[model samples]
Target: MRIALLSYSTKPRGGVVHTLALAEALAAAGQDVTVWTLGRGGDAGFFRPVDPAVRLRIVPFPDGPAGESVGERILRSIATLREHFDGTGYDIVHAQDCISANAVDSCVRTVHHIDHFTTPELAACHERALTTPYAHVCVSATVADELAAGWGLKAEVIPNGVAYERFADTDPAARDRWRRRLGRYVLTVGGIEPRKGSLDLLEAYALLRERLPGLQLVIAGGETLFDYRDYRTRWETRAAELRVRPLVLGEVPDDDLPALVAAAGAFAFPSVREGFGLAAMEALAAGVPLTVRDLPVLREVFGPAARYAATPEALAAELAAALTGDDPTRRTAGRTLAARHTWAEAARRHLAFYRCLG
Candidate 1:
């Protein structure tokens, strides 16, 4: 099968990581895979290298001002992509986002989020794009249900998989280095966005500090993707008022994340919305016990394997317990669950989906 994976703006983000992993897996499984991505503006490092078996086709476009509408840019990108795919004869064109223009072939669309449906104009855009005759794939059952309820669109749920070997490879020396410098800290891995509930995590950390002194909170990710600087500032002020120290390690590289997760006493994810919690999965794969919000997506992904907390206080309590407890049962359970969700299984499922297109 010849598959074309499309992403209008593929940066070094979770979406891009999913695309790369899927493309590589398909190629390794004896399928011809081609990735269509936008060219990095000026920095070569912005783009990740694809597997040798997978072909890459980059379409260059104007990196315009922030004020330029994303819909207009995506339309232009789709036009460019159509020209590129004119003769390639791809068996299936897998579009990552709802607004992706390359839904030209026997397409499969993945709904990463439903934010566009909130606005009138954007909702119209989504309705138009989603009306395309494509087999839709949702990252979680929660997302699938939302799409079916909101837009009368049914989708298959295909949860993302983590590279177990990469995460399970724990180096005691590297873990010791991080533990020595950072001490026993609760780690949260995600951009400081409102939907991520980072501020909520900060508030929980503040409350936790009142009871358990010297408990450090380490946040690992880049700055907020959206304009939530005021929210971030407010959290910082609240942390300061509560005299809670937070180690804001912004945008750590992918290679260093496993060690970061392994060294942490416990992993925290208080996100209110997520198509799928990739970071939480990574932490679980790294043998780090997780304390996540009692959200549908988290519940679906972790099941009874993870400890759930409803409020910030509950989350803090769970975190504290996981950190101080000597029992390794939860860690063992998380590893076992994560090992079951391998990229090879994901690849086989994806291949089956692609075959359905024909």
Candidate 2:
């Protein structure tokens, strides 16, 4: 089968990660696959190297000047991708996000998460991306239910696949490198975005420090199409008010991320909303203690392998427990769960879905 996988950016965002992984999986299954993406900031390739079997098409996408509105950027992103995307002659065109969905006339779209846009143009684009897709796939059953309840659209639920062995068998020397540099730390992937609950994590970390003063807070991975400077400023202000100092590592090298995950004292995921807790799952794969928000999606994805909290206070308590009271049985179960989700299985399911559509 000939397939084209579409994503908005070449950055290390979750959706982009999914796009590359899925494409490689498909190629490994002996299917011809090509990935299409906008190379923002002159990025000629993905943050990490991809499988040679899967072809890549990186279209140059320059950033808009300073002070560009989020709405304008969204529109420009859609236009830029639309102008460069050539879906013709492909057996399937699978769009991984709203921008890619909006770029094409007909394609299968995977709604990783639903976003509420205030701008009229962006709101319309979001609506169209939700309603116009020929078919839809969601990463979790909770998100699938959201689409069903909100739009009366039924979607296939395909949970994300984790690189189990990569994380589970991290080199001790590499993990030691990160541990040595950061000391004992609570790590959170994804940046200081509102949806990520960055401020909430900081608030919780402040409370956690009352008992665990030796633990530091380390944040990594944040690449997005939208602007979040104002929200980040508020997060910074809150961090200051709470007298918490967090080390924000903008983007960790992909090669070093697994070791980084393995070295953490605990992984914190306080997302207000999520389609699937992929980072949390990776942490589990690494046998790292995890504390995530008590959201339905997270609960569905993480299950008993993780600790859950609904508020900042609760989160602090959970982190404290996870950090100090690590259970060998729970960690074993987490590794087992992570091992069950394989990219090959995901690719088989995707191929079946694509064949059904064809």
Candidate 3:
């Protein structure tokens, strides 16, 4: 089968990662797959190197006019991608996010998560992306349920596949490097965005420090198309008020991420919204104890393999518990769960779904 997968940017966002991985897996399954994305900031390739089997078409997307609003940028992104993309001759055109879905005339969209945007242009874009797609996919059943409830759309649920072995078998020396550099710390990814519940995590980190004064909070990865400067400023102000210092390591190298996950004392995921907790799952693969927001999607995905919390106080308590002891059973369960989700299996299922659509 001939397939074309589209994503908005070449940055290391969840959807872009999914697009590249899925494309490679499809190619490995003896299918013709090509990935299409905008090379934002003159990026000629992905954050990490992609497999050679899958072809790439990275359209050069320059930065927009100075002082453009987020809503205006979204519209421009859609327009730019639409102008460069050619959906002809492909049996399937798959869009991985709202921008890509809006770019193509028709596509099979993977709705990673549903966002409630307040901006007029953003709200309309979100609506059109959900309503206009020919078919829909979601990474978790909870998100699919949300789609059904909000738009009366039935979607196929395809859970994300983790790089199980890569994380599970991290080099001890590399892990030692991270530990030597950062000491014992709680880690979170995805930056200081509102949806990531950054403020809540800051409060939780402050509370955790009362019990373990030496423990650090290390944050990594903050690449995104949307601007969150205001939210970040608020987070910084609150951190100052609480008298806590956090190490914000923006965008760790992809090659070093597994070892960083393995070295962490505990991983904290306080996102208010998520389709699937991929980073948390990676932590699980690395045998790192995890504490995440008590959301239905997380509960469904992690089950008994992780600790859950709803508030900052509860989150601090859970992190304390996670750091205090070693739960071999939970670690084993987490590794087993992570191992069960493989890219090969995901590719097989995707092929079946594509065939059914035909």
Candidate 4:
């Protein structure tokens, strides 16, 4: 089966990671896979190389002032993509975001979030683009439910998977480095975005500081996706005002993430909205016990393996307990659960989906 996977901009973000991994997996399963993405800015080395088995096609889309409205840019890119895919034959064309408007015989669109419903123009564009018959894959039931209720679109739930071997390997140097700075630290991985609940984590850390003097918080990942610099600055100032120490490691490389997770005492994710929390799963796979907020998708993925904390105070209390408590049983359970969600299984599911389209 020849499959064309479409994503306008395939950067090294979570969505791109999912698209690339699935493409590689499908190729490994004896299916011909091609990735279609927009050309990278001046630096071609920005994106990691795709697998040798998978072909890559870059369609040049117009670039203008970064200050231009996103809606206008999206419409322009969609028009360009439609022109590019005019005669390209594919068994299945899988579009990643709501903006991709490429027409194909059998199309599968993955909805990570519903941006269109929030804005009138985007909602109209989304409705127009998605009116064509296409199978929809939602990363979480929450997203699917929201789409069904708001947009009246039906979607299937297919959770994201991680490469187990990547996190399973432990780097002694990383552990030693973290141990040197060590106090009991709660680790949070993601961009400092409102939806990610970074400010909430800061608040929770502030509450934890009074009780635990030696407690530290390490936040990994860079700036917010939507250019919320003011929000991030406010959090930084708030952390200082509360006298809480935060180690902000911005935009870590992929190879370094597993090591960071392995060195942490516990993983903390207080995100309010997420299609799927791959960072939490990676931490779990690395044998770090998780303490996440009560979200449906996370609850379904982590099950009884994780400690649930509702409020900031509750989160702090839970973090303190998890860090101080020695629970090999909990760690074992988390690892066992993480083992079930591997990229190979995700690959097989995608292959089967593609075969069905054929």
Task: Pick the TM-score winner.
Answer: 3
For residue 248, model 3's alpha carbon misses the true position, in angstroms, by: 0.2
Can you give the TM-score per candidate against the true fold? 0.88, 0.98, 0.99, 0.88
**Candidate 3 residue runs with Cα over 4 Å from true position:** none
lDDT of 2 by residue, 1-358 (tens): 9999999888888999899999999999999999998988888999999999999999888878998888888899899999988888999999998888999999999999999878888899899999999899999999999999999999999999989999999999999999999999999999989899998899999999999987899999988776788999998998889898999999989999999999999999999989998898999999999999999998898888999999999999999999998599889889999999999999999999999885
**Which of 3 and 4 is the better model by lDDT?**
3
The worst-scoring run of ten residues by lDDT in candidate 1 lies at 40-49
TM-score, cand. 2: 0.98
Candidate 4 clash pair list: none
Cand. 4 Cα-lDDT: 0.75
Model 2: lDDT equals 0.92
The true-versus-predicted C-alpha distance at residue 145 of model 4, in Å, is: 3.4
Per residue, candidate 1 scores C-alpha lDDT tens digits across 184-288 of 888997767777788788878887777678878998875322346787788778878877779989877767778989899889999888888888888888888
Backbone clash numbers for all candidates listed:
1, 0, 0, 0
* Candidate 3 lDDT by residue in tens digits, 264-286: 99999999999998889999999
> After superposition on all CA atoms, how large is the RMSD of candidate 1?
2.8
